[model samples]
Structure formats: structure tokens, C-alpha cells
Target: MAHDAAYHWPPELMALLTDTIPLLCRSKDDVVDFLRGAGTSEALLGQFRQQLAVDRGAVSKYRIAREVLRQLNEQGDQGLGVRRALLRRVTEFEDFSTCWPDDQLKARGLVGQIRQVVGVKDSFTRMQQERDREHEARLADRRAAEEERRRRSALYSDLRAQLTALFPMEDPHKRGLELESLLNRFFALDGIGVRESFTLRLEDGEAAEQIDGVVELDGQTYLVEVKWWAKPLDINPVSRHMTRLMTRADVSGLMISASGYSAPAVAECERFLALKVMVLGELRELVLLLEREESLADWLRQKTRNAKLDRRPHTLLGVDF
Candidate 1:
């Protein structure tokens, strides 16, 4: 018969009889006896004894009750009945020297170790997520830099094309002169506020000749000569030209060449403290300055076209030839 109510026992008093039971008996009579020993009321004990006698002849009923007690203990119930049953089992096993074998104990330990390794794998997954974020950030930075460089390169190429179209020249020297003039004009239009050129009469007076270009800044005049020599430029001619311009005593001179300069020419140019010399590579930077002044670019295009028409032989004839 199943007990109709629950019960409790103090652990200190219960420990004395813990090893006395064998195989943890769960008979109703055992329950009644435990309650009576704990000083339960006679009325409650009488009711329990009546229930116990109803199944006294049925062994199967007793077995079922024992199995229920075992399940409750394995599931870790805190009820007094389950606790008493668990303590009885512990005592019975201790008295009989019953213990799990080495192999079974080892298998349990390995299962616990596997659980620890799985926890470490979870931490690795988190670290890999952090690394993926960092890698994506670096890739984003590189793409931004590459995009900026591509934009600058395109602007430079466009400006170069425009300059070539505006100042097409069969002679490389004339091309150099045209390039210098356009660059100076662009500089002035961009608010540099400098005089850009001057004409000089030769001593023999065969024809009037113009110096390449000039710029005035802060009360100083800078005479300039431009060269587009595909080969190296000797500085002697440039030095001589600058000397002539400097005869006025008020002018400082500069020389800009598309091709590189000879070493001696560079040294000669350096001799004059007020003179500056720049080569093709340096001149390429002017395109960047022009990009910031779009109006100057437009004016240069117009001036170049007008100059072309004026120099045409048909225009000189006064009729459409």
C-alpha cells in the first residue's frame, strides 16, 4: 500500500541506524515503524498500519513500492521519504562492500573531460568572430585608399589630354614654349597675380625676339626660359639668356625644362641665389594646381584656339582660302 502522507527524520538520529538496513527496504511496515520511532501520534500510526495491512499478502505490491523509492532517490528529491531511502541504500552498499568497477568509473571521468573541451571550443568560436571583424575593417581601409588614388589618377589624365589638345606642336621646342605660356596664364588666372612674359630686341636688330616667360612677385621680376628637349638640356644657353634678362638688375631668372637638365646646367642655375630651375617631373605637378582652378582651364582652351586661328595662313590672306 502507498503512504498517504509524507514524513521527516533528523539526520543526526538517523545516522545511527544508517548501516543497519540491508538493500534499502521500502515495505509499508518499515515506514510505519520509522514513524512510530519518531514519536508520531497514535491516531496517525493506526491509520498507516491499517493501510499497510491491505497489501500485506501481495509481494508484487511491495516490489512496486521499492522501485518507486529507488527512482525518487536517483532523481534527488528532498522529501523525507526519498532522503531516508537514499541513506538506507548508501548504508546497505557500504555494509556489503558494493562499488562501481574501474572501467565504469573511468568512462564517467572521460565524459566530464569531453564536456570541458566543448566549452573551450565555444571560446575559440568567439575569438574567430573577432578576427573576422578586424579583417573586414582592414579590407575596407584598403579599398578606400585605392578608390582615392584612382580618382586622382583620372583627374591627372584628363588635364594632360586637355593640355595636349590645346597646344599641339610639331616642334618640341615650340611645344615647350606653348606649354610654359599656358601654365603661366593658368597660374595668373588662379590669382598668382604675376606678369608672365617679356620681349627683348636683339643687338643686331634682325627681328625682335621674346624671352620664354617671366613672373613678378613681391617687387621682384623672375625671368624664365622653358625647354621641351627630349634629350638632356645644356644650361649654357639658358644661363646666357638669364644673364641678358638680369642685365636690367631688377629681374631674377628661372628656367623650366620638360626634359631633364645637364648636371653642369643645374649647378650653373644654382649659382644665382634668386634663380630657380625645375624639370619635367616637377612641371607635371602644375596639373594639380590647375584642377583647383577650373576657370583657368577653360580660358586656356579659348586662348589656344584663338591663337591657332590667328597663325593660320588662310586667316592671313583676309579671305577663306
Candidate 2:
């Protein structure tokens, strides 16, 4: 699954690259600029420049280019990207007319050689990508299933710990916050979109409404209100949620109660079902579903279905709808 970390250029390819560099540029200054632009170290270029000044005719520009390329090749993969860029740039030059007329054909030939090398590399890269795509396609479904199992298992473990911790939390406010966080994580685990508790402000910056969480399921938005009261949630809080739902057009309501719902509260939600879909949930049922490793998204879909079809605001997980 791993590729080689180093790229070793062949002796022939090195010679081709070195020979092509001088041809790609018209003068020694052009040669200096070309190497400098290709990311050659200033120290190396300085050494080349000093040598050129000392013995202008003794060391040829092609020889200096070869030395620079050789040192880069010794750097292995570290220099591979720069070398490839140089090769690509060499091949991109359209005019050899600036080259000496006698050496023009030779320059064209050297550029052609570099192009062939670059072309082979590109073809190999494309082939590798295509093969990787095909390989991934073969394992996509199984890998996705395994990844989902792992993800849900992790989420379940986290939620179970959070649930256990909630029992010992003495502060009702902190416990309510923890429960809202737990519910958000549970919904998000199965890929349901969730927005944590947020307060909507009025025009004067006063708090207009406090939403425990927001969740989107089956293309419908639901304003979520989570209550962890000791007694069964009565009609007052439920009615407040109903009033909030009334202000928003085409939005539904999801109310989760830790202490369960009183008959009147359930009846209140049922009344609101005529205007908007309202799905009520008990914390115990959610705990049970998590214990059984049930899908929260699927369960919500079923709850929404039952709410729409049977006009029932609440349904137990194990009970037949």
C-alpha cells in the first residue's frame, strides 16, 4: 500500500535533462536565471557564478547545469518535484529559433526526449490513479459498512458514559445541558443534522426564545426542546413549544422529556399535530434504542411516518405502530 519514498533518476534521463537545460535558454545569464527560477539554492548558483567568472571558457554552462542536476538527483525524493518541474518547463518552450541555427535541431531533439520522459511519467500517474479508483470501488461498500459500525460503536460508548455520568449530576441545570448535548451527539452520530442549544434574540437584543437543539430529518426542520424535569412534563412547556412552532411556517416540533409526558401534554401535542407534525420522545426509549444499537435516524423516520399516518405524536420503539 506504500510507495517508495525516493525517486532515482536514470543516468540517461539525467544526461537528457542536463543537455536540455542549456538548449532551453539562449545565454549563460539565461541559464543562471533558469536554474535560479527552478529553485536551485543561491549558494550553488553563487559557486557556479564564481567558477564562471574565474574560468569563463574552462567550464561550460552545460557542465555547470549537469553538476547542479547531479547534486539535486543525489537528494532523491526531496529534489524530485523540482526536477520534474524543470523537465516540464523544458518541454513547454515552443521556440528554438532563439537557439543557434546549427544547434536548433539538437535543441529540438533534446526537448523531445524530455517531453517523452515527462509524458511517460504523466501516463504512469494517470494509470496509477485509475487503478486506485477501481480498487476503491471494489471495497467501497464493505469499507463503508465497517466504518459505520465503528463510528456508531464509538458514539454508543461515549453516550453510555455520558448517560451514566448524568445520574450522579446533582445540578438540574447542568444535567439538562448534558442531556441536550447527549441528544445532539446521538442524532449527529447517525448523520442527522444538529444545531446545539441556542438563544434567539429580539430586536432589542433581549432573549426571545431558547431552543434546546435543532435537528433536520427527512428534509423537514424540527425545533427541539429537551426537558429533564423530575415530574412528567405537563401541558405548559408543551404549549409553549406549540406557540413557537406556530410562529414558523412549515416547521415541526420534537420534544424529548426525561420524566416522560403527562396525558394532557401528550394530548396537547396531538392537538398541534393538525397544523404541524409533532413527534414526542421519552429519554428511556432513546436509552433502550442505544442499548440495542438501533439507528436513531431510522427510528426518527419511523416516528415521523407514524405521526403523519396514524396521527400519533409518540410511539414506543418496541411497540408496533
Candidate 3:
């Protein structure tokens, strides 16, 4: 479409292209064969390709003719012409049969009324490339998410094994202290920070109670009690935990017993219902959750919510899903 370069084309070459517009429908191979048969050499071929871009000197005379020949062989048809001293332009359907019969060019219009193929091939190629890239990006994101989940699961499982190995201690008081240490280490590994046993004051000079453990995890304060007694804990101990929790309306309580509770105590806890006050947990559930590499903080929060909403806790037992 560079009319100025066309202007540089020699008048003889311009006349030749205008006269032989129908001859442009041939394939590149057919055109080459014709040129070779006519004794046109490879040097002439390169020289002809050069003239289409610009007219530097004597070689530029055939530029417009060669440009039309190139486009015809590639696809469809294009013609060179003069209008107001500029080249007239249009790309039209090329008739391949014209090359074989050598007579179809005269039968068809010189720059005929064949409809333009609306560039479907180019658009399809571009859209497919975009879809491939999007698919690859989504696959990469899923792989990264899976790798992070596996890392968290492996770390939690290792810490769980350590905690499980310490369960055989016979002395209740020493076992309770070791259990508390293990709980702290487990909580830290699971990304929750905890505080040691603290003395709770009743807004007076006297200390009201000694908390077994205190932890602010998942936006709630937990007042924890750990018991590893050989005997099943009766209602008295469970009732004591409920009383301490009731003292502070905002605090949630965790009562983890290795030996578990008596039938009457379990019955009392099942009937116990309050708002974010108590969460009944077992040493077994902690072991399972850690062995499965699950989040203890998340389990505690669910239990705490269940106490308020469902009026029941200790639902984490034997859960595999």
C-alpha cells in the first residue's frame, strides 16, 4: 500500500502488471516454473523481490509487479493500478484453476467479485494460544496449593508422633505437667500461642483459683485443665471446670482427660449448654487430630461453638473425613 514506492516503479513494469492482473492467480511454484522455463535466473528472482519494498536505483523498476505476484501466490489476489498518480489497491479471491488451464483468467473478471474470507484462520490460531496459556496458569496454581497442604500435613504428623510417645507416664501430677508442655509444643507447631498456668484473682487480694493452662487462640481465651488420672473423672471435677468458666462470662474452657469422664459426668456434660463457655475434649481426639495433621485451634473453636449451638461437645472422636 506504499504508493510512494509504487511511484518509483518503472513505467514499463507498471504497464506489464496492469495488463497481466489475471496472471497473478497462479501458485508461487507455477510462477517460478514459468520464470525458470523463460530462462530467468535466481539472481533475477532475488532482484525482483527487492524492488517491491523500495526503488533504490535501476533494480526498482519491477517492484510493484513482484509485490502483486507474491501476494497472489500466498493467498487471494491483489492488483496494481494508477489513480490520481497513486496506486489503486484491492485484495480479491484468487482462482487456482487459472494456472492449470491457462485460460480461466480470461473467463473470470480481472479483479473479480469473489467474497473475502473474513480472516477466520488467523483469529482461531490466536484464540487457541490464549486458551492454552490460561489452562497452564490454572494448573500451576493448583499444584502450588497442593504442595502447601502436603507440607502442613507432614509437619503436624511429626509433632503428633512426639506427643503420642509421652502418654505412658504413671504419676498423675508429673504426667499432667508433661501433657501441658506437649500441648504447648503442639499448639505452637499448629500456629497458636499459649500461656502457662496462671493464678486467677476474684477482683480481690485473695487468689480465687489456679488455672491449669491459659491460651488465647483463634480470638478466644481458653482456661484449660488436664487430668491423666487412672480413675474415671466424676461429676465433681467436670462441675468444677464449669464453675471456673462461669466465673468469667467471656472465657471458654477445655477439659482434656486421658482416662476420660465417668458415665454420670458425661451425662452432666451432654446436658450442659451455654454460650461459648465449655468445650469437652479428650486426649484421644488430640492424638487423632495431630496424627491426621489437622488444626487443633480450629477443632477447639468448633467444639466451643458446638457447646453454645448444639449443647454437645467431644464430636471429634473417630472422625476420618
lDDT of candidate 2 over 1-321, digit per residue (tens): 243345466677778888888876777767877888878777768887887778777777798788888787777877877776776678787888888787789989988887887688779889999999999987997899999898878789878888988988899999999899889989988889998999999999999899998999878999999998989999999999989999998888888888888999888787778899999988888888778888888888888988988999988766443
Candidate 3 C-alpha lDDT tens digits along 1-321: 233443433344344444444364344444444444433445545654454336444432234346544443333122222221122232232544654476465424443422111234347658998999999999999999999888877777767766766767567677678788888777776677688877868877689887888878868888888888878789999889888877786787788987777878877777666344666778888888877677787888788777777777656555534
Please state the error at residue 63 of candidate 1 in Å.
99
User: Could you tell me which 10 consecutive residues in candidate 3 have the lowest summed lDDT?
Assistant: 76-85
Error of 2 at 51 (Å): 58
* Alpha-carbon TM-score of each model against the true structure: 0.36, 0.56, 0.53
Residue 121, model 2: lDDT of 70
How many pairs of residues collide in each model? 0, 0, 1
Query: Candidate 2: where are CA atoms >4 Å away?
Result: 1-140, 319-321
Against the reference, the lDDT scores of all candidates come to 0.48, 0.84, 0.63
Shift of residue 148 alpha carbon in model 3, Å: 1.8
Give residue 60's lDDT in candidate 3 (0 to 100): 27
Ranking of candidates on lDDT, top first = 2, 3, 1
lDDT of 1 by residue, 259-312 (tens): 556767655544543342221122433444455434433433332233234321
By the lDDT metric, which is better: model 1 or model 2?
Answer: 2
**Candidate 2 TM-score, true structure as reference:** 0.56
